[model samples]
Target chain A: MHIEVVANIGEARSDDLLHKTVIVVDVLRATSTIITALANGCKAIVPVETVMKAKEQVQEGDLLGGERYCKKIPGFDFGNSPLEYTREAVQGKRIILTTTNGTRGIQKSMKADHILAGALLNGRACAQAAIALKKDTVILCAGTQDVFSFEDGICAGLILEELTYTLGEKNVLINDFGLAMRGSYLHSKDRLFETLVSCANGKKMSRSGFHDDLILCAKSNIMDQVPIWEHDQMILLPRSLARSTF
Target chain B: MHIEVVANIGEARSDDLLHKTVIVVDVLRATSTIITALANGCKAIVPVETVMKAKEQVQEGDLLGGERYCKKIPGFDFGNSPLEYTREAVQGKRIILTTTNGTRGIQKSMKADHILAGALLNGRACAQAAIALKKDTVILCAGTQDVFSFEDGICAGLILEELTYTLGEKNVLINDFGLAMRGSYLHSKDRLFETLVSCANGKKMSRSGFHDDLILCAKSNIMDQVPIWEHDQMILLPRSLARSTF
Candidate 1:
């Protein structure tokens, strides 16, 4: 399979993502939060681009969860932190989420046949989901405000490494950016948490009192759940569905 | 020191580059070729954005050197390969050089206080020169046709690593992309030639019968000379001048 790793949402062309599996990665921490919320039994995540749209998407039982400039939106249920997305707070609930970069990335990739939320937390499962879908993939790194972020690139590297491992090196063709990300991931695999802490977003998040979130988002493949976009909402792919494809 | 590593020439902003030392890198093989030609005692290199501009820039006794689509331009004295620029051929001759990416990078960086050509072959020297210039630095990777290339990223990584080594890790503040490039470089430093051979540009160059260029461009710090833009031409920075700043 061929994989194209884009640097950020701004660089991803909607035309290029058509008929391909686009894995939207925002390691710190939009996708990470979505994965955590879904894994904690949230029914689905309605990711919108604007704050007003996020509020409009919400129904009676839906919760508003997102952040702007790393702070929780005023009067929202939660911020963009995986740690805030707990089992008790999010169970069986539909969440209307909007953030600076990640949701925009999801919206930008609306042209893809399949869009999966990927992060270091569920990289392997995401890779498996992509393989099962049987399409060439585009790993779009949701960088901070259109600037390339190290955390997202590292997560892209993780997903690429996982894909390479499952498909064998000869069968997987990666773009130059993907190759660089893979090398970056391999070099920092042993110290992911530390590596994230040193990156631009990580440092900002840490200064904003999101240290726990960083630690949580930096863990690789800790959760088996992979969040796949369906019916305009992100829902966890059933384990049986992924396994049966193999 | 603050360092910003841009992914390609298209991403480099002229406003941000002002008052900074910009290191333009095109490891496979524009910057590498310029460094080779300069080190072979070439008088200077005039980098132009177009073939017509290159032709117009050449004066009496000046040799035209460059490539279009990796092949020597019609009736030009040389191609982009560093091997073709031997001492016997380039010594004391002024070279009007233009290539697909590297020259474009240099032209884009013209707004900077200082512009230096960098590659894996002169990464250390470029870092040293930037330090001596005493300005915030920007390493611009002249990727292939506005897309990121692994070779130039690796060269940026090498320069970042060298900067960190000389300035100490805490003293050097690098952008997120620079950090990723540093990690990628460290991961592949032990087998740079093999790493380059496997990259997108490397494979293309090799297939086009420029395997020797890839091998030569992949070697790190083989030359101590750094090419600096001075009075509209790229000339070797005198060692005395670099040392005097210290």
Candidate 2:
């Protein structure tokens, strides 16, 4: 029942998250994109580490959805924005997803016994699911290029708060970085998104004109569908697929 | 000034810590060894990444001090424990040091414009020296093999606390992780030393009978002579020859 939220997949790996139930978050778009795609009825999301891998993995029926620097790859089917993962376009189809940070994060977590995709969009659902699973959980924020990202930290805080709220504090074992993320979120709850954009990773995304994507990605608990990773594939969970999933 | 505490040397590199002044901490003994060697009156500490390089670099005048794990190597002059760095032994002597974690961390911070050694024993001095330099600082925790170690996090918290107290909150840019380490210290202040031994790295040390080393390493603010990196060598500050530097 311990909860550890590392700054990124790198930090998560350093924390020895292999045997733990890991929840990977890339709020700026990977997790959000995958969550949105799944919520819209996409069958399953296949996350690949690199764009080259994504391109090679896609079959005739699968679509490529990812970005290099928050922009769509030239030949990919769609960009990394969640707005691109709509019901009409992605319904009932498999997607080969890759991104600069997110997919590589998932690939790193491939060794975890349980790897769950998490984001502010589906944060609550993800937390509740982790709590229900009732094991030690490691929240891995897929930070921008292994550096700390305010967006990822904020989203990790939301997940920490949610998990702690649901599971109680005694069950939590937060690392120093995780504690700071929770404190940052609680202290700046009102301006989390705006303040986040000023951080190192946030500024990079803003300069890339992906600020709008931040708005979409930062809305806490907006989406109820928790994208759970099972057997190396990301699929909609029972909670996310239930009648009240919307 | 922005102050970030990366959990490991690897994270420090990924975060582009080269742009800032880096305070490297390997609390379980590398920094402790350096601090002790200096405290014991050692002239300078030459940090090398690997044992082979450390062995290769020492000359006729320099003494070699370091360890691979808890055990001292067969031919090495000393173990990593600070207690072994007695004043009579190290006085005015140069020590070529390498350890499993600490020396590697110092080598990693070679990319940084300015690098200083940090430990719980010298946390205040390290913070004050970094602030005196008036540069953005990054506290690089040399966590055990790239993972978050509780002892290093606590030491980082001690540095952050010292910095915030001396420089005021407005003068520091506290990242989410930094804030968390501060919170962690506050939450467990009464039993800080007890908490340290319970950590992953600390327990291993305890089990290996180096528990005394942990206690020695955990003492806070014992010295005022902060060691700084100059010309790839860690020496006491102030370029004056008359200064009683180790």
Model 2, range B1-246, lDDT digits (tens) per residue?
899887776566644766678888888878877877886789999888778988889899788877765678778888777888898889999988877677767777766778888888888888777777778898888987777777787888888988999889777778756865665565555666677776766777889998788777767877766788887788887524213222
On residues A1-246, what C-alpha lDDT tens digit does candidate 2 reach at each position? 777777766555534766777888887778888899999999999988788888788889898887765667898889888888889999989999886677777777776777788888877788887776666888888887766666777777788988778668776777655765665565555765775565666667788887887777767788888777876679987873322324
Best by TM-score: 1
* Candidate number achieving the greatest lDDT relative to the actual structure: 1
Error of 2 at B56 (Å): 8.3
CAPRI grade of model 2: incorrect
C-alpha positional error of residue B233 in candidate 1 after TM-score superposition, expressed in Å: 0.7
Tens-digit lDDT track of model 1 for B1-246: 999999998898889999999999999888898999999999999987788998888898999988777678998999878899999999999999887688789889888999999999888889999999999999999998999999999999999999999899999999999999999999999999999998988899889988878789989988889999999899999986555222
* C-alpha TM-score for every candidate: 0.97, 0.68
Best by DockQ: 1
lDDT (10s digit) by residue, model 1, range A128-229: 889999999999999988899999999999999988999999999999999999999999999999999999888988899888988899999888888889
Q: List candidate 1 segments past 4 Å from native.
A: A244-246, B244-246
**lDDT accuracy of residue A190 in candidate 2:** 70
